[model samples]
Target: MRYPIETLGEALAEGIVTGHPAMPQFELTPPEINDLLSYLKSLE
Candidate 1:
């Protein structure tokens, strides 16, 4: 989409595979991101 699939995957994997480094923290695994992304795509 906006940043290319690989780019999006990387961003998702970061806070996911590792963990958010800053405040207001949250995390998502690869599978969770994929599911969220899939839901988002369905809205279009």
Candidate 2:
């Protein structure tokens, strides 16, 4: 099953705050996060 789009965005937001294994920690505005999530959802 696929994960919810909002969940993905939340995870991404958290990862950016906590830092992911291969990703550097960075801050993103809410709109930016929404844009990213939109793009990711397109791929799904």
Candidate 3:
């Protein structure tokens, strides 16, 4: 899924590691990461 930011830091912190090589180029912020977690949680 795409995040608000453009970094993979947030996704990695959340244990959502992706095998895609381009993932490293993405940039994500703390708040945006939090939002991603919240959204992911709702999927449960």
TM-score of each: 0.53, 0.53, 0.47
Instruction: For candidate 1, write residues 1-44 as lDDT tens digits.
Output: 25555366567767533344565656788788898777767776
RMSD of each: 5.0, 3.9, 7.6
Each candidate: what lDDT?
0.66, 0.71, 0.62
Per-residue lDDT tens digits of candidate 3, residues 1-44?
Answer: 67544454445566665778776655557777678767766776
- Stretches of candidate 3 exceeding 4 Å from the true structure: 1-24
Off by over 4 Å in 2: 1-4, 14-23
Whichever of 2 and 3 has more TM-score, that candidate is: 2
Most accurate candidate by lDDT = 2
Candidate 1 colliding pairs: none
Alpha-carbon deviation at 20 in model 2, angstroms: 7.5
lDDT of 2: 0.71
Error at 19, model 3, angstroms = 5.0
The whole-model C-alpha lDDT of candidate 3 against the native structure comes to: 0.62
**Model 1 residue 20 lDDT score:** 48
Q: What's the ranking of the predictions by lDDT, best on top?
A: 2, 1, 3
